[model samples]
Target chain A: MGIEPGRLQFSWISSAESTKFVEVVTQVTNAIRALGPNPDFTKKLAEVA
Target chain B: MLSYAEKIREIAGRLLASGAVNMVIGFRQGTIPMMNEPHFAKNPAEAAKLVWDSHCGINLANYLTDRKEKIGIVAKGCDSRNIVTHIIENKIKREQLVVIGVPCQGMVDKRKIALKCPGEITAVIETETQVTATGNGFSQSFDKKDVLQHNCSLCIHRNPVIHDELVAAPVEEQKGIDRYADVRAVEAMSPEQRWKYFEDLLSPCVRCYACRNACPLCYCPTCFVDESRPQWVGKGQDPSDVRTFHFLRAYHCAGRCTDCGSCERSCPVGINMRVFTKKLEKDCLDLFGWEAGLSLDVRPPLDVYRPSDPNDFIK
Candidate 1:
């Protein structure tokens, strides 16, 4: 559903600690959100989020 | 000293008074002194009975997360570490807690301590400042540190991790080699010999699930063992099956097991569950350089993964 670990890291660590936490959570939550609500880990996460 | 006791009462009473939590879990003198079971005080009146000392070692925070109502808890060193993991895992919300952190010298291990006492045997009894065993119609008092649980023997984190109030100034953390260094002798055995070693140890297991039930981290509403639809382990007495249950459950607590020793302590069958849990405890520290539940910030290593994570087995 998402591009790559390197891409995730860039989006995540490219900023300060608070920004980093938000960046990573947003990226990962967004990636899982992209998979839609199907009850599999990715989809279920998105549905909840 | 009355004030110290009263201070404990005050923190618990105020937390109850403020509507800060729905229940406050602490230790109360059980029918027996040696038996420190987790206790709950749903109101200020019940909070008065909460007590402390080396005897108050049982981790009450283990009970907090599973309940739907918000609760505060009296946490000692080991208890707070377990609480830390519950927070990291999202098992309990941090805001709902009112931690009454108390310094711990160590907690008495009723079973181990009983053997060392003067009696051929009798019940362990306690008072506010001293603990005595009444056996053979006589009583003798011992210093609290003289007979403590195996974990507390090597415990360094003798202060609460997260506390709203402190009971006493924190004691300097103790340092000692792994008390379960005996497990290494078992590790030196040949595979076949090691197999026999575990075979000897776990053979007594009745599959009573006492260890699982006692574990703070064994939080699934339906555990893997209970999944009858696709059984992770069959309900059988076969040696391998017994081994699988012990091995998996011990590993399940890898970074998560704070060596609270609740598993082996609560087991009615007298299995040496410490051997397995301590091995996992040492391995997690050695391999990952990680300790579970020490802080709120770090995610548990197993539950949160990294692409660069190490594994010698992976090609």
Candidate 2:
């Protein structure tokens, strides 16, 4: 319920659209990098691991 | 004005006597006022014990998992939907089942009745229009429609999508229902407020797994909670642990849950766990125009993906 909005991304691309897929992936990687790691799941991940 | 109990017994008896099925799964009257037990009838004599009423809220499809015997089962709208889910998920074979479908009105919410009459309910008499509860030196009556479980009141599917036999003609589905009112209200809150809302909502969880066990869709051989080498959730009553458990449980049932209200019904402390699952149900509907357990031909939402699917949330 407390999930921050920027921590996740969703995209739709067909298999033939390789350039579009790479562009979208690069954009998402940059956006997530700006937001940093998700604190909510990171703590739980550490506990479980 | 159909006599459901009598019809159930007749069908069950015939099935068992004719050796069409080895067992009939339905409800028997409980010792308590408003509770009923899921029962298995092996013969005509045992089939005679089967009874049906509004208190038959627990999903009978939960009992169909991994059973080898050819069975006849009494199924309400939600129960039959879960049966379809079981068939699709390989929990049970379609040929192995003889589904006796009943047109459900709704199940009475015992918690609502308790709030109405704050005494130990000694007896309950229910008709199509009213529910009368009598207890120690007190009697109370409420309109039947008012005391329905929250999910039932908003249910759109009142007739079985699949059935071998119908106990009665299908009832009219509820129209003009605002099913996502609660979900929308929660969405309107600030993230911190929403966080506190859920924290308070799940604070009473005892982690008994009744909610998990009650769900016909939840039949994993070994659940993620039970993972030992990489223990996903701590066994203690930590708030974080409780929240994590609820989150994962709801996520696991993304496109599989049929909103049968069994999880909420089985909670001893009366936790409204449907809040979690309902969000996913809404997402599935909006994104994929999908309702779980409606058909055996199509796969669940998460199982199939479309290249042209909407993805506005992406960067």
Whole-model lDDT, model 1: 0.73
**Which residue pairs overlap in candidate 1's backbone?**
none
Tell me the alpha-carbon RMSD of every candidate.
12.6, 3.8
Candidate 1 residue lDDT tens string, B195-297: 6678789878989898898888888888888898887776877666677788889878888888777787788876878788777777778777787678888
Candidate 2's residue-wise lDDT over B1-315, tens digit each? 238899989999999999999999999999997799999999999999998888889999999999999999999999999999999989899999999999999998989999989789999987778889999999999997899999999999989889998888899999999999999999889876887899889989999999999999888999988887899988868778888999999999999889999999999999999999999999989988999999999988787666756775432
Which parts of model 2 have CA positions greater than 4 angstroms off? A9-49, B312-315
For TM-score, the strongest prediction is 2
Model 2 DockQ class? acceptable
Give the least accurate 10-residue stretch of model 1 chain B, judged by summed lDDT: B120-129
Residue B248 error, candidate 2, Å: 0.6
Indicate the fraction of true inter-chain contacts that candidate 1 also forms: 0.00
Q: What TM-score does candidate 2 get on C-alpha atoms?
A: 0.90
What DockQ would you assign to candidate 1? 0.02
